[model samples]
Target: MVPQNPGAAAAGRAAPVHYTHRQILEILSGLMIAMLTTMISTSVVGTALPTIVGDLGGQDQLSWVASASLLTMTASTPLWGKLSDILGRKLMFQSALVIFVLASVGAGLSQNIGQLIAARAFQGLGVGGVSALAQVILGDVVPPRERGRYSGYMGAVFGVATVAGPMLGGFIVDADGLGWRWCFYVCVPLAIISLVVMQKVLKLPKIKRDTRIDIFGAFTITGAATVVMLILTMGGKEFDWSSMWTYLLAAVAVVLVIGAVFAERAAREPILPPRLFRNPTFVLCSIASLAVGVAMFGAMIYLPQYLQIVKGMSPTRSGLMTLPMVAAMFVTSTGSGQVVTRLGRYKWFPVVGLALVASSMYLLSRLHVDSSKLVIGADIAVLGAGLGLTLQIMILAAQNAAAITDLAATTSGVSFFRNLGGAIGTAAFGAILNNRLTHHLTEGLAAAHVRPPAGGGTSLGTPDAVQHLPQPFKGIVLEAFTQSLQTVFLVGVPVALVGFVVVLFLKELPLRSSVSRVDQAPSTSPAPTDAPASTPATAPTPNTTA
Candidate 1:
């Protein structure tokens, strides 16, 4: 056996300590709380948006409220990740929390849709930081083999927040004098608590580096994302598809993307490293992430509409009705993590998961106006299981496959693509819903020998509006909505199938058993001059916890 070094032991004791499982849990408590705050903030706003728009009187600006946040979030995600690597993770995370809380307060107090949209855009910066860094920090603290279990817990938190946000928002909206503003305010206390907890429990080693902010690259990418999102969000709804505005926006997006590629290539510390694109694992994972985002967000946004409009369920009831999906997702995500930790295998999970997502979407497409809630619940439960298995595992695979230096970039890259996909999917699917609804409504009204108003189906905004319409007109509108949503689900089926196909090509690597790659360092590196005479020159042994 090699002799221990007295001087080395002294230095080790003086150095910053690594975290134990208990300490990590303490840190995760803060992280999860922060994550929950972000999730709730985004989700809660959805149910309250109608009320907000009505109060603020900007029906034209309604979609911007969601689109603005998503646009900024996608654009800033990579920058946040790169910053964390250059600066310290903990400081960046806390900064993100403060920004989010302040923005939430601003949102709560907004007098117009413009102010609310602006506040949400600012809030997206904070959200971008938190979402990217949360995953990065997990990679920092936990070894790959053990990270799966913690990922499951995070997924469960995500699932719970998703279901609860709408329910809570609906309750607050219907409650006397609570109003839509409280939807934004409720997240404030939770965020404050998260910030305090993180300050107390989180301790990470700070690495000082020369920071080079990619200002031009940041601008180009943000512009590109904004343009793309605008085209998607406004092309069909705000402007005719054949209009010059659509073509102009699309052209501008293409140019910005090209410029961003060139800019990133020359930057000292690129926001998204071009080298990552060369990695097959990163590329495949990004594609799958994009497809998953498209599928998941499309369903999440449209299904609630189906429940509220077709079934005439209240927002609270619609949120509660989604419990079956959330519960199944929670169970599967948690269970899959434990299984991955135990077996050290994960490729099968996503492969099977995507298959289920495709199947669920197909099943949902078959629903009609008279379809029972039980059937709807069963279909969505399948979707939840698929999402649980696929979503977190992609991040794990990307993290495991990335170089140590590229960890944060990889995490944020995956997130960026997912957000991009969601934005595009939501907009594209929304356009589809609008177009199909108009066509069906026109046909149904004409068939019923009823004349549509002069604007021709322009007044149909929410399910609540449709619900109040007289007898046969309401029935016709409900049928149109049902058929339109079915088309949306049918479109989603192919997107999920693409993800399923892509996941099949993913090459799984053995999960790492340590936080760093020190064990894998070359054995030829010279030892320190002050080393003990009897010290071993071999590489450090890896932890074999499993």
Candidate 2:
């Protein structure tokens, strides 16, 4: 017989176990701590990277530092969700915290870029869990109607982390003798505190489950995602776009995905169940997520470059300049969440958000070398407003569409795709920026009657030396910056348009308060062999797997 409380067998005794309001609050606080701490780690590093790369003597590896984290996080996202479903929420949450803390320490102490990237990959595994599982657990503790307020807090935490990360990273990096490694050092203590608080305060019902996990599906999907990411990373950079290497990688990714599809179909408990894709809301939301991820990530990643490269701002100053956008996002997201919670409606946000995003991107495309700082800042603010409206609400939409039991997995699936899109966007757009910049620089050199450098195509955007170019050359470099940034905006326009289209098809569903999952479960009364009885609402249908 399945034990009613799984923790009972471990404790070997009955324990008092009704959760009160105060107890639930205490439990949620642990999750909030973990959420803020993890987001801080992500944003802080992005701001400090310029300093870190200069010290490490490998500017080439800068993208990899970020890419490594995204890759592992994307690949492991569904695994975390599936495992949490099988292993009990509290166990997975605490385990994720411990892994994150240890990984934070390793990241801080790394001596080389390779070590740093490897540590980040490991750290990402925990980050992947924390982000996915937190939302999952939140769905458990709160009903859909009440979840908006909490989701708002999550958006605020995200905004705060993004805004604060750059400032904090800049401070730690610029502080005399503290060095860039301390940026990583800063989060370690916070993580420890989060861990202790979680252990002390968090108490979730343990699911007494005994089921086989879809190990093969996890492996296949991970393989598929990794291969696809590699293709995006290496295309038009390390290999020719039409080269054999490109075709080979593409083929491998395609084959693995086909295998994964079949594997998911057969698995007793799939990591990413193919059936979820058939839900119209889930499908549209996922598509919209891809577009939103591309637009948001590509723009954010490049704006700092525009500040540092063309505007001639220091890393710290650039980070500060980003405050307006991040700040605007924070306010709007929190306010919108509360409004949605109170009004009981949300269909308009995505439509309006994508419109704002598209308009803002179009405005940003108009930026040139001579554009004023005021204009650029204004554009970023508009983009931030769009993002504030889009990101978390799509998650709410996905949650509302899913069955109660699939809440965590469905939410994480949306998150996983969004992040996966971001990784691909960042890598792909970075390559585009590099290629376009090089081409413009070459054309400028040719027009100026200047000889190409002896070794040919030496790096032109070196941070220490870019500002020192002669007057006409500096103008040319800035023009290249303008051109490359314009291309990013051009690419983003179509992405937002696509998002607009997908969101138009989404069906509106009512947001409900928490369901009584335990109360609704089937009764264990023995079947009466001799009398006809009415079927219960909880009785399993013929096709029901559960």
Candidate 3:
């Protein structure tokens, strides 16, 4: 229906009228750069670890290399999202990009493992914003119907990064006079460019209303998350799982988490509005995302190792070998997104995707030393297709459920749980792999009647020293790695199964109208019975709350 007074609607506009195509591209470019930075840093380190550990000095810190980044990102995601709501997306995105760039430089220059880990932690904080806020900004710029196509673009960036990161990292690590440091250095300039692009192009109407940030709640949540993750990282590796120190730390973490809940409940402008939990669609999507994270990241982190150690490929070769999986993910993510947009229902995609992923994980669990490369590649591609379907679909589902007012928090909440699941999955899976590897290494050595090596276990610092060993010892180590990796895959199959179950329960909702429709409240709907009965034209559509 035509507005009786277009001037009144125009005058009541809360923010800028619209974004031009140039502006949208500019925002997307910055987001792509941010993702490129994250994927490169994550994948590059996997290939460079041997060289890095040789130079830096601790095998134990190897997991921390990745965990450091996950720790910071998982813990700080909500704060970044919440802060964007208060301070504006442009500021948060720019600040995060700058931090990541600076940290990358610091990481490249680091002389020791401690310094490197510290730098990675700082870098996580920066990239975390990009990871969480990119969706938030997209929620502002794109409607749920159109979002699937753009989300596909984001997935393609991720796939590109997975391929480029390891290949470039391997080349850099092996290059004359370059070494592993260049892996960290290469992404710094790109991050700087992303920051510049965001500053210039990411213009949107800010919430001009008064806002108060929940500083205490933010601190408690971060502190609590960090404490728990720290315990996970250290327990069973640095200290016994049953030790008093571990117990004490775990207790403190529980206390802090409880405190954080109460703080959030009472705070003004809480990081995660508790009400998001009340929506069944939001709750189911978040659960599915968490499980997907556990399955997705836990396997990706170890897939390259399976190729390099068990299959005995070089780092560069391993990177190339993993290409099919990444490529499949890119194709399926984009393809499934288009299908969902056209079909306007996402439930079937996740259900089918998780089932495929579960099947792939079961196939992966059956891998042994004699497994064919072609079969392995096919298995990985299956897993990737599952991932491609589930990961971004969950994000879009959450966005569709939320009202325009709570878009940032809703998108960020989905990301926050996915990352949290990843953090928990990576740590737990790493611990399980370590235990299984140790057990199998001892068993294999006993069966071969050979003495176990001094450093008989897998840790970040496990040297190429083993890489050069003779006879049954080398064979035994390879056996241990294969068995351990297979066990991890076995565990992941069940997790994916859980995701399948959860996705099955998710309700499909109609994709909402455009962002413009959300912004301009409709002037027609049924009036509340408690109020005076009104004609359709005089009634207003009910405002949606998160």
lDDT of 1 by residue, 1-546 (tens): 112334433433112235678887987898899999998887777766655775676444555777677777788899899888766788889999999999999999998878998999988888888988999988878888899999988888889888888899878877888888999899999989998998887776554444478888988888998888888778777899899999999899899999999988877668888888988889888999898888887777667677777888877887787788899899999999999999999999999999999999999999999999899999989999999998899999999987666789999999999887777787777777777878898899889998765453544655566677777778888898789888988998889888889989999999988765544333355543223346533323212111
What's model 3's lDDT at 472?
76
**Residue 198 in candidate 1, Cα distance off native in Å:** 0.5
Mind giving the per-residue lDDT tens digits that candidate 3 earns over 259-301? 8888877765678777778778888888888888887777767
Per-residue lDDT tens digits of candidate 2, residues 224-265? Answer: 988887877767778988999999999999899999999888
What TM-score would every model get versus the actual structure?
Answer: 0.90, 0.89, 0.90
The count of backbone overlaps in candidate 3 is: 1
Q: Tell me the spans in candidate 3 whose CA falls farther than 4 Å from its real position.
A: 1-13, 20-23, 453-463, 516-546
Which is the leading candidate under lDDT? 1
Cα lDDT, all candidates: 0.81, 0.76, 0.78
In model 2, the runs with Cα more than 4 Å from the true position are 1-25, 58-60, 452-456, 460-462, 516-546
Count of steric clashes across candidates, in order? 0, 0, 1
lDDT of predicted model 1: 0.81
